[model samples]
Target: MESGPAIFAGAAFTLFGAALLLWTGVRARQGEPVALGVAPRAAVALTTLFGACFLLLGIWCFGRL
Candidate 1:
């Protein structure tokens, strides 16, 4: 696959993950539930991991491009 598309897709994924993290934070501030059936700490860990993956992937793709 071309590095351009991969870079673009990776950037999109990273942004989406960032948006999710931001939403999660807003919900937490409002005293709302973070995730169904998941502990708050675990949910945060999962979110951080997910976002980190996207960020790293995007960086890698950008480097390749």
Candidate 2:
């Protein structure tokens, strides 16, 4: 349960989330569908999930430290 791993995870997740959001935005502007039968809501949900994971990891890491 070392804080190092949690911190790394947090950073990675945050970066991933940021990238996803950015990509989604670009795709949206291009008027491309993210997935078949999937709407903008789905993308928002995915972004939220990633953000939550990052937040949880960050809290865990800070708590450990």
Candidate 3:
């Protein structure tokens, strides 16, 4: 497998995931309003889960590289 593209993709995923996680953390810390329909806790949980998935995917891709 070509490590170049994989590494780039992994870095992108990691950065995006980190950004989402940071945003969620800031929102929670600031007691900001969450999106409609979902409860505050659920929203945070979902965001965290999504961010974790992305982070893990990125790590796996980086490992491949």
* Winning model by lDDT: 3
Q: lDDT tens digits, residues 1-65, model 2?
A: 57778678767765766667676667767877755677776875676577566656655555666
Between prediction 2 and prediction 3, which has the larger lDDT? 3
Error of 1 at 18 (Å): 1.4
What's model 2's TM-score?
Answer: 0.58
Looking at model 1, which ten-residue stretch has the lowest summed lDDT? 56-65
**Between candidates 1 and 2, the lDDT winner:** 1
Query: Per-residue alpha-carbon lDDT of model 1 for 17-43, expressed as tens digits?
Result: 777778777877887777889998788
**lDDT of model 3, residue 53:** 92
Best-to-worst ranking by TM-score: 3, 1, 2
lDDT for 12 (candidate 2):
73
Cα lDDT, all candidates: 0.77, 0.66, 0.90
Report residue 38 deviation for candidate 2 (angstroms).
Answer: 2.3
Q: Cα deviation in Å at residue 47, candidate 1?
A: 1.2
Screening candidate 3 with a backbone cut-off below 3 angstroms (N, C-alpha, C), the clashing residue pairs are none
